[model samples]
Target: SHFIVGLTGGIGSGKTTVANLFAEQGIDLIDADIVAREVVEPGSEGLAAIVEHFGEHVLQSDGQLDRSALRECIFSQPKQRLWLNECLHPLIRKRMLELIKQSTSAYAVLVVPLLFENGLDSLVDRTLVVDISPELQIKRTQDRDGVDKGQIENIIRSQMPRQQRLDKTDDIIDNQGEIQEIEQTVFALHKQYLSLSKAVLS
Candidate 1:
């Protein structure tokens, strides 16, 4: 298997920004969010199952998943949310691994928001967590999404705690500062992973 780095962060952490840097370095990137959408595309089994379970209302007139509607649905209904996770998690994992297996880069970076929380870290060779303080996470998320402090706090509360995530990770990228500061750190990790992957191949 190719070396896989499981990259994750809390809601406000700069996971996407850091992942974009890796992509710019010609690294293969598989994002859980993208894979989630791909799995539920109009004609896919994932979408079919969702429609069967949640009904046609979850789909837009154009046949795409009404993401906002579905999000609202699951957010309010715990049983429905559990059902959805059970249905989608395996499908998402299968697709993500397939993409990783086919990757041509020296190694692949897999980005997932709830990587550790969902136990996805076991699937990757190395785990990279984008870290920031809870206060910073709250502030950044508030600024970027306009979410209220209480809601953001609930979200942070639901995920694996910051210290625990850091403990489990093989590497951490401090994203507490400005977004522009991540590029050099990303490049440094890129170089390390390249050599580490080569050593494995040799």
Candidate 2:
């Protein structure tokens, strides 16, 4: 198997940008959010199970899962969130490993937002934490998502804290800067990762 690197960040921490940098370097990136959505597509077994458990109220008029409705329900209720995770995480993990197995790059980057909270870090050989201050996280999230202060705080609080992520990481990329700086850092990291992978393989 290729060396697996798990990349994680708090909400609005520019994880997508970092992942894009890895992609540009020809690294295979398995994005959990994208995979999660795919697994729950209409008529899929995941959707069927979700509807069965959550009732049809979680669906929109077009018969697709209403993500907002589901988010609202889960965010307000920890048990509901846990139930949803129990239902979806395993399926997502199965599909993610399949994708990882198929990757043709020197290594793979698994971009999972909840990597720590869900213990998905065990799947990867190394963990890269994208660090940003909580103040910036809240501000960026508010500006980007139009969420109120309370909602942003709730979302931030719901995840593992920034310091905890830093504590658990094998590597840290501090991304609290301009886009160019972020790009430069990611570029450097990619080269380092490639070198590390080569050394391991040899």
Candidate 3:
């Protein structure tokens, strides 16, 4: 199996940008968010289960999962959120692990925004956190997502705290600067990961 790096950061922390840089280096990536969406895609067993539990209100008129409505439902009801997580987390984890096992790269990047929150650290060989200030997070998320500050704050509150995430990570990328600089940092890490993977294989 390839050496796996679990990449994580809080909402609006630019973790996706970092993951894309790693992908540019030809590293295979297993993005939990993508898998989450996949599991809930129309006609999937996961979506069927969701409809059974949450009812047709969670579906749009076109028969697809109504993501916005579902988000609102979960955010407003703690028990519903817990039930949904319990229902989907296993399916997501199963698919993610299967993808990781099939990867053919020197190392793989598993990007999970809720890595710590979901206790998924055991899935990877190391953890890399992208760090930024809360102010920047709020600003960037607002500019990109146009979501209310309160909603963004609620999301940040749900994830592992910044300090705790930092404490648990094996590496950190401070993403408070230019895109070029972030790419440079990723390139360096790419080299380091390549070396580490080679050493492990040897």
Candidate 4:
């Protein structure tokens, strides 16, 4: 079997940048966000199911999911959010598994933000934690997400804590430095994963 590395980090932690480094190394990347969107495409089974449960209000005039409107509804209502997650997660997970099975690379990278929170670590051979300080994470979240202090704090509180994430990771990428430093760490880890994959195959 090909190596499958689960890449995770808290909101605003540089997991996407690390995934890009893996892309540069020609590793297959299975991004859960991308899969989530795909499964909900207009007229898809996932979209149909969502509409059946949530009604047409969740869709745009053009019949696509009105993500902004949906986000507002979910963020304000926990029951709605959980119902939506229940409707979409299994569909997304099924599609992601199919894609992972079809990957042809020596190893595949699964970029999941909630890898530990969702217990998705079981799907991979190793876990890579992209680490950053809580202060840095808060600053980055506010700047990048255009969120307020209270909203950022709430989102952080909902996720698995940094300490718990660090405790479960098989490898760590410290991302509290310059972009070049992050790239260097990712390149080194890429080489290490490749070597390990080759040895296992041999």
Tens digit of per-residue lDDT, candidate 1, span 153-189: 9999999989989888899999877777887889999
* Reference-based lDDT, each prediction: 0.91, 0.89, 0.92, 0.88
Candidate RMSDs in Å, in order, are 1.9, 2.1, 1.8, 2.1
Candidate 2 regions with alpha-carbon error over 4 angstroms: 68-80
Q: Estimate candidate 3's alpha-carbon lDDT, on a 0 to 1 scale.
A: 0.92
Model with the higher lDDT, candidate 1 or 4? 1
lDDT of 3 at 127: 92
Worst 10 residues of 1 by lDDT: 176-185
Task: State candidate 3's TM-score.
Answer: 0.91
Error in Å for residue 117 of model 1: 1.1
TM-score of predicted structure 4: 0.89
Tell me the RMSD of model 3 versus the true structure. Answer: 1.8
List ranges where model 1 is wrong by over 4 Å: 68-77
The positional error of residue 14 in candidate 1, measured at the CA in angstroms, is 0.8
Candidate whose lDDT is highest: 3
Looking at candidate 2, the ten consecutive residues that score lowest on lDDT are 178-187
Task: Report the C-alpha lDDT of model 3 over 1-202, residue by residue, as the tens digit.
Answer: 5799999999999999999999988999898989999998988989999999988999999989999988988987989999998999899999998998999998999999989889999889889999998889999999999999999998888788899999999999999997788888899899999999998898
Return the clash pairs for model 2, or none: none
Sorting all predicted structures by lDDT, with the top scorer first, yields 3, 1, 2, 4
After superposing candidate 3 on the true structure, give the runs of residues whose Cα lies further than 4 Å from its correct spot.
72-76
